[model samples]
Target: MLCRILFAVAISLQRVEAVDPLVDVSYTRYQGTSLLNGITQWLGIRYAASPVGALRFQAPQDPPSDSSIQLANEHGLLCLATGASPMDNTTSEDCLFLDVYAPTNATSKSKLPVYFFIQGGAFNANSNANYNGSGLIKASGMNIVVVNFNYRVGPYGFLASKEVLAGGSVNNGLKDQRKALEWMQKYISRFGGDPQHVTMGGDSAGAASIALHLTAYGGRDDGLFHATAAESQSFASMLNVEESQYQYNNLVIRTGCIDEEDTLACLRSLNVTFLQKNNFNTPSPGAQVAPIAMYNPVIDNDLIQDYTYRAFEQGKFLHLPAIFGDDTNEGTIFTPKNTSTIGQSDTFLQSQFPALTFEHLRTINSLYPVAEQYPNSGKFWRQVSNAYGEQRYICPGIFISNAHARDSVSCNWNYHWNVIDPVSAAAGYGVSHTVETSAIWGPENVNGGAPASYSTTNSATVPVAQAYWTSFIRSFNPNTHRLPGTPEWGAWTLDGYQRLLFQTNATAMETVPDDQKKRCAYLSSIGVAIKQ
Candidate 1:
């Protein structure tokens, strides 16, 4: 009798294992895979109709209706990029998919907080594949859900001209991000994610994307996301659409559509391969050796009406709780080498922002004069790196943090990521841009192995970083669920300028130094000349 009861229990366990992890949204069923790590993931789920043929260059459209049970086992193709990318071979114009990861035992009624991330590649090359959520799911103790998706990039996404704007659209990439957010609001509950409690986060260009959304449509609160976390945010020049017409004209001429009645229609009608081949053939006049980003967000007077600096100055942004900061040396990677002379450094700056006059350059040089004690990659490399980093990444982060503290009723948290890596320090990229990403996402998910110390000598930093980030995602405040023995992270206030310093075994709250504050103030004073 005891042997028979054991056999019955074994059969019951087998039956439980046979059930498939599936979800239904808007009549479409998705068969997901249950990872061995206790997380259930639905990959390559379509969020919008394919933007091909007539839909090319237009805003994202609703996905077509389907009742079939589609397999969500592998990632979809990445969106076509403007230049060489890590994974360009697997790209297509039809890419508009998102991935979702949740606890295996979660039900529709679980209503766990959602963390939606956007990947960055200078608004050109990169995809959601770089960020796998399995580790983050485990880090959260299988309590929260994680999501990431792809969007259009390059000329296909940011092309701006009267003809293109009138006939098709502009900023389609930003629109693509919006479409994915709308999809989450509509269907995340099926994956046990609470749409109403979503936290949007990103790094580099991804962080810049979040800043645009915060000020999009004149700070319109669309009820899409509740809070934000950004690292190395950038606020590039916001030129008028007409200023970029030269690039649009060059593209149309190269594609043999300049003579056509409607250039946008002609370009869209061409085959994807022919267009992709021609996308990189034409280069703007005096385009730098390490070329400046030509295709950028424009002043459309609709989605993006003005510069991000001006928008924040006018208090025109969502007053949501936020965690924003930058690395100690953001410009190390962006500044070009072999700039042995001050002339070369000045040329580089001019190439980045053409609107800067001689006087503006002089002011920038005076503000960031070469320091005697600074390390050298070039004669004036450190000076140029400091200037470029402040103009692009560092100041922009401070701008957002100050704006949040001054305008928002909700608390704002900021950090300075200075955790040193032996490999990076040896390579001269001291706490470079996006260096802390692996820690936030868990070192295991990084494409190549993460820094050796992340898993060995400095292993303790990983859990601490994850705890603060996930804590913010789960609750609006980061202090609520932080790990034991960690320092209390204080909110950023206008008077204090307090921010947390995230370092290995030495994390603590610190104040922004007075000198850096003066530099940021000078940059803000010349916002219009730089077009930021």
Candidate 2:
């Protein structure tokens, strides 16, 4: 009788567990929770093995196969970041996880287009834990699936040295991202996503990553993605792996591993806390106003064979349908506030790229002359801001758009997001970098509300912006499913260089400004010397 009772209890447990949404990717089974908003999310699924112990600083390896029913409920610990302070408990080195959001009714047969987004934090710190695809899914009429994942950042992700090159990978962070994309291509069909129709999207550093991937392996198409969306794409100085030896040496000295003969092995053997304590000791890119990123991607030749500008110029990047654009005042948030003279501004540029020669500085100053005509509180702030914005973010975007246009393989849509938030305007950041992020992802979803004004007076802009984004994910063209009555986004061309200006109540197509065009041309000519 006792044996019979135990069997009966086991049967009851099985019946109760059967009601939740489940997906089987052959090697593993995931039980997902259904949210009240008709969205089902399978969160915190490991795509790669923990990059700890012998795996530290190495290319990502596939996770071990498992058959158990894993609960995909909460997110995993964020990857340890450099200089992210008061260091929180919710961070770890074993953080190679991803999340998937889709309509509740989606099945293996749904085959919805997928949007795989890479979060931006200047390559030093940041993760995709806070992003929610519910609003984006709803905006797409529940016709798509979205994926976000974490990649190793800072030293763990980007440490480069001769010792490292011999034993481990040079660009582990980027390798982690590529691993996640490969995971999607293999397993996304189980989540009702089309492996063949994936769209890769990102902002800032994330966008910059997509740019690198486009040119990775000398433009070798990896069959990972079909389209691209790069908002505020950055083209910073990318030193070859050898040039980044100073960063590696500084880290070794700080961590007390300088005496170790096998520095890479010594680093892998050290405790994570000991290593993290010294991560911030490395040289930082940018100035007082820029994000404090101590490390950046190095040109590894294996992955990044040449500078991005040369890749595009030689037509060595994958030609794909893409959309590239930036916010109006991208540099306001990244430029120094007290640069009162042209010399100080040159110093700021040198801080970002120490390799900038005196000739380059002279040319840069000549191109960006003192425009006292512009409104600003600082003596040379606006001029410096314009120079930083164009050289770093804006011009790179335009160059890539033009490169795509030269290919003429597929349509490339470009936009200038000039919509101002009252809060940002008051803070002296007029339509600054990442201001349109809330417009793309719903206002309420990002970090609980940085641009909460979108839900208030600027509410009308949300649907229009999301419509263009989601429409591009669903179809290659943004105009395909763009909201009715909104100005049609035109494909950028070498001749016209037309782009849609996204302003509240006055959205329209405009030609690339002559001032910006001339500046970008000069910057593009010196792309090699700047190591862009």
Candidate 3:
């Protein structure tokens, strides 16, 4: 889910003597620069060929090599996003690019660990530009390389139908990520990154994408990543290829492709402007500010063989040591206020989970009573938040963590993020979605993230969270005493599961059990297992 009201800040570029950074992939040379804080950033590196023209709606293909030194010094053009405002207007179909941030002091022999992050936008919004891994490079104490990149999104990324399936390429966006990983495996050594030590991390849709990769091909070892970290990971029920045919046909109708001799060809031929303008990103009244994910990765036969929940139950995922968690009130922002009464909430629930039957809706309503049941507002918003948080973010976290813990993997830990920005607290959003996103990026660039008061909580959390993350990146487990006041992060266990509680307040190192165990169980029983 995208966070609200993030004013983008500009980073002033500094010119230093060309450290003469270079990467030669099959004779194609990329000359980058050591620009910020001694971290050599190689930007706009192509991981795959442009997914345009005949390549539209197809899996990512190998990037053709170049002869000259291609300068990877700028951010790649963003994938065309639906509903992007006119002010921050920058997008294109030629956005299959990745950016690498490495320590200048490091060499090809350094073999430093790599942290690859995917930006979150509910799979329809956001780009790699939202996150600059420069901060994370410094936060890792010059020991790790950070990578962020753009992937296809929305209709271009994921729009399913018989035509889409028959085209022999579905979930192209996921494939784009896979291909990027493969590229890093073959080429990151030139950039001082360890391919075998790559740790994948992200928030929201990015995290969800990681989960799909974990289960891709029924746990086949692709050797793409070694460890994973996720915040507010989604367990949203995914639609099968055929199940998304209605949406696909609807998109065809909306885009004037329905009457074409070759509707798929018509879709393929449409320009970025036309396609971005015509999309499935219409916000549902149900998700409030958050999107309902009309376009997302589906259970395509290749990448995703079966339901993710069923896959997890059957141990059909690459079991790795992971750190995953959710915020305290993850659902508040997604829970719309217009849903007040039980009937209205039921209506909203039906819209959000269209597959749910009336009985399922009734069960959900019973599980989450109206706000009258709470102390303050006599509306169902907070109740809705509680239910949605447990169902989507919190419970899926528990389920996935438990799945990892049950395996022989060591130090699979979970955490609860309760640290709300003072601005967000005053506005009643609580520690909402993507609150830790900036913190995960680390404390190098400071603006718009810290609270006004700048309490001890603020001072400690910034680096403390960084320590937990960097430790995990350096080593699979986050158990660290590097940062002052940071707690001993314990692993999730079948005997006694525990999660670290992260708060802006002091001594918040408290280990707690799953917060909403019963509610999560109820959700699982009702088959509200994953979000599409």
Choose the strongest candidate by lDDT.
Answer: 2
List the candidate numbers ranked by lDDT, top first.
2, 1, 3
Clashing pairs for predicted structure model 1, backbone only: none
lDDT of all predictions, in order shown?
0.81, 0.82, 0.73
**Off by more than 4 A, model 3:** 1-19, 85-88, 127-130, 282-291, 371-378, 443-457, 505-515, 528-532
Encode model 3's per-residue lDDT on 1-532: one tens digit a residue.
0000110100111222323487787847787887757888888888999888999888898888678889877778888675664234467787898988888877776777789887777777763354667777777677788888899888778878889888748888888888889989998877877797888998888888888889999889979998899988876657788877876777788889889988898888886566666664543333332246677788877779877677776788987768889888888777775556776665555556666677777777787765423333437777777787777778778778888877765658888887757776666667888677767675434335544433444656766788788877876667542476566777787666678887764524444444367677667666534243
Error at 241, model 2, angstroms: 1.4
- Give per-residue CA lDDT, model 1, range 60-119, as digits (tens): 999988978999998888888886543456988888889998888777767778999988
User: What's the TM for model 2?
Assistant: 0.92
What's the lDDT of the predicted structure labeled candidate 1? Answer: 0.81
Question: Listing every candidate in turn, what is its Cα RMSD in Å to the true structure after a full C-alpha superposition?
Answer: 7.5, 8.8, 6.7
Between the candidate structures 1 and 3, which one is better when assessed by lDDT? 1
Which is the winner by lDDT between candidate 2 and candidate 3? Answer: 2
Model 1, C-alpha of 213: deviation from truth (Å)? 0.8
- Give the TM-scores of the predictions, in the order they appear: 0.92, 0.92, 0.89
lDDT of 3 at 131: 62
